[model samples]
Target: MRSAVVVPETPVKSLFAYPLLLSLLVGGPALAQTATRDPAQIQAGTYAVDPGHTQVGWRVSHFGFSHYSGGFSGVSGTLDLDPKNPAAAKLSIRIPVGSVSTTSAKLTGELKGEQWLDEAKYPEMTFVSTKVEPVGADKAKVTGDLTLHGVTKPVTLDVTLVGAGVNPLNKKVTVGFEATGVLKRSAYGVKTYVPLIGDDLQLTIDGAFERRD
Candidate 1:
């Protein structure tokens, strides 16, 4: 037999590196199967209200009577979307509290007062998202903090992504969605009347934001 050649073996060879490498390779495809995992792949867009098409409307119980509804005229927002990673997303909206209309100036003033929106003191109501959780292929839950009547509270919205595609006007990708949530006005220090105008306020928003240029 030829002279044996001795070779030093590494006792601490990395088995750990192999799986990590494999995971990096296969993990992407696997995670993609459920939702997007690429944050950088997501797009950011700004949406201006058509004013004609968009609306911010709310309804509340009227002394245990029929549901009374009213809408706001000025509404605007922007959307941050990550198609490759749905979890990494955010949305924000702002509306003028004084824009509430009820077909009566007296009612409008009342809405602006402390009994309702208290618009003179708090001119605007805003919602800023904290986290995004995809509900499915096209639905999500947006957890955010909403400041209304100068009171800030955490709120969650059930969101349905209407669609995302190209826009001819701006020549950019656009996304549309509808979200709804309900909150007790009193919870946000909006407490004033209980059964007269009702405490449960239902919020509905129809928004469309386009990719920024």
Candidate 2:
């Protein structure tokens, strides 16, 4: 006698299961509420710099061979903003010169030495905005007094609003920006290499500020 064979049952699949998993992995709805670039969404008040997320990057030509890059962290600052009057916005930031870093340990250490940044003499670099001119819907020209290596010079940063919204993890109102500018190292008394390492330093700043008010 042949025994009856039992058929294995096929498991049912929920149509919503795959989409739910994908949404969570790719940050669907949660990401939408966290950030926005619309200037109208920004709240008017004071915002303190989120140092952990802010950085000032520098790049310069290396003996006409390649461009070398480095960055300075441990930034602190504040932003006083009014969406209705972006031209009147105020900005002030301080960056620890000793925080400068590069891929090469020796190069990084040399940058902090007397002939370079002279971090011992100038512990910090500072910028205070003297004028904020709105150039576009989300762009501006921020002219500030940049003090580096004990010398102060007027530096204009072409700034753009990156985003403004509530930070998902910290639940704090946050705003971000990117700025680019160029300055001659000689102007700041950092003329060690001169034309060999490129006198002009290209600066790029990624700044994050959290609402304090």
Candidate 3:
């Protein structure tokens, strides 16, 4: 008798599987929720952005059906804090557009093309705080120039101090903050599919910095 023929089943894969897997591999562990504490009495100085601990995420309405989201890595920046005078605080952040990741590879490729971010021409985007307004002991309104898609626009973000303390493992003073803002892509000349893809996008930044001096 002829040997029975058999076929192997193929595994199903989602478009976002790779992105999810990459996020998991890069993200070490889930952060524990700490009790709300007053902002640390941080010394007046400059702090270096901890790239590994920084995450810049964005979400946009897609055809009014869902809010699709993605994130960018490779962040490098500095924070000049003025505890005595919070308004004198300054922040300079740089993000490489090429580091943007999405759920789909095709979408990512398109975003890097001329129709969208045009990453080749504008490889990096920056935000330099123009003003800082302290609203509370642990919250502030940060206004800055956000440059993207070869265009620059004024944007404001609501920032809150998460926590600040000495890191047990790194043995360094670390500060954490979370910020949220909204921007219209069309204003920045990224009007690919305006209404359909969504013109307004929400941005959230969770960052950790180590004191340099």
Worst 10 residues of 3 by lDDT: 28-37
Cα lDDT tens digits for candidate 1, 8-102: 77455564557756677666433222223233333554454444456788998878868888888777776666677778777778889989988
Q: Superposing all C-alpha atoms, what RMSD in Å does each candidate have to the true structure?
A: 19.0, 6.0, 10.3
Best first by lDDT, ranked: 2, 3, 1
- Backbone collision tally, model 1: 1
lDDT agreement with native, every candidate: 0.75, 0.93, 0.89
Which candidate ranks first by TM-score, i.e. highest?
2
Q: Model 3 off-target regions past 4 Å? A: 1-36
Sequence-dependent TM-score of model 3: 0.82
In angstroms, the error of model 3 at 92 is 0.3
Tell me the deviation in Å of residue 20 in model 1.
62
Instruction: Residues 115-187, candidate 3: write the lDDT tens digits.
Output: 9999999999899999999998999999999999888999999999988776767667778899999999999
